[model samples]
Target: MSYYSISAILTSAQKVPCTFDLPIPNRGFLDDNPGGDIAAHTPLPLPLYLAELLAVQQLDNRPLLTLDLPSSLQPRVLNALKADAKSVDLRGQEVYFFEGAARVLELLEEEEVGDGLCEAFKKRAAEIADHARNARGGTSSGEGGEFLRGLDEWERGLFRAAHDSSKAVRMWMGEVKGAK
Candidate 1:
């Protein structure tokens, strides 16, 4: 979540569903009705950064907006992750799924989503590590290829690090054996 992290910037651009708690003038462009006032209780898909900012702002001791969970963290997706984290196409759902979820959770504080994401990441990390260690010069096909293709930005980084580490370990072992 650093200021210059590309992932953070992308996550901030993700859209989250939010409802306006109070009507505001000259804000209908957000709902595709430019030059008009946004009606109270109007639901709109706003970028995470704007939504987070408005959600926390107090207008007469009431929040300006109510942020809802993004579609990526909806119940159906969570259920799929819970059932089989390896099977879920996180990249298809969102390229920065985990990072965006972390941001949204910070605003909404949903324990279930947090727990589900942690469990899914743990399960998928083990699978990713296995694939990384056993990879044969990117020759994976069929199921493995499909799974690898579905990895999000974070998961892809994890896969790359794990793969490189495994390769390094193999190289180190070879050097040690040759030294003996």
Candidate 2:
């Protein structure tokens, strides 16, 4: 097994559809392009949920708000976070969403650690959704939809982080690997 570790700071989180941003390093940015700089995103926050989505899609390398772990762990870490997305709920959701997001912070620690936990959470959420659908004969209205929409926005933030981070990660990983 490879000995790798990752660590990240939330950087930013705001209420009413909470959003968080993670900062990327310049070195990572420069890896992809000759003149690339992480500073370009300065003063602008990159969403964490969006970051995970991009990682899940493999549209980018790793998220900008990543740990200093081995390059190989990016996908694994991202998968873990995506798996956690399933835990979202519409009823009294934001409160739970915050908790759920916080819980995944450990997964953000690295690509490999606590990966399956996310899968389990997501699986359970899906089952609950299925059960609700069966009971209601369809989806509910009002609060639930609103909450789900909020969740989507949160996910978009993650996607944003992941996409931005991916660029930096990919660039850096490529250079480091090439040099090796």
Best by TM-score: 1
lDDT score, candidate 1? 0.92
Worst 10 residues of 2 by lDDT: 11-20
**Model 2, residue 74: C-alpha shift (Å):** 16
TM-score of predicted model 2? 0.23
What C-alpha lDDT do the candidate models reach, one value each? 0.92, 0.39
Off by over 4 Å in 2: 1-120, 135-137, 142-147, 150-180
Give a tens-digit lDDT track for model 2, residues 9-126.
2312221121212334444332353544544233322244444432234214534343222222235534644655443332233323333344344435543344443464455445
Q: Work out the TM-score per prediction.
A: 0.96, 0.23
**Model 1, runs deviating above 4 Å:** 137-139
lDDT of 1 at 23: 93
Error of 1 at 10 (Å): 1.2
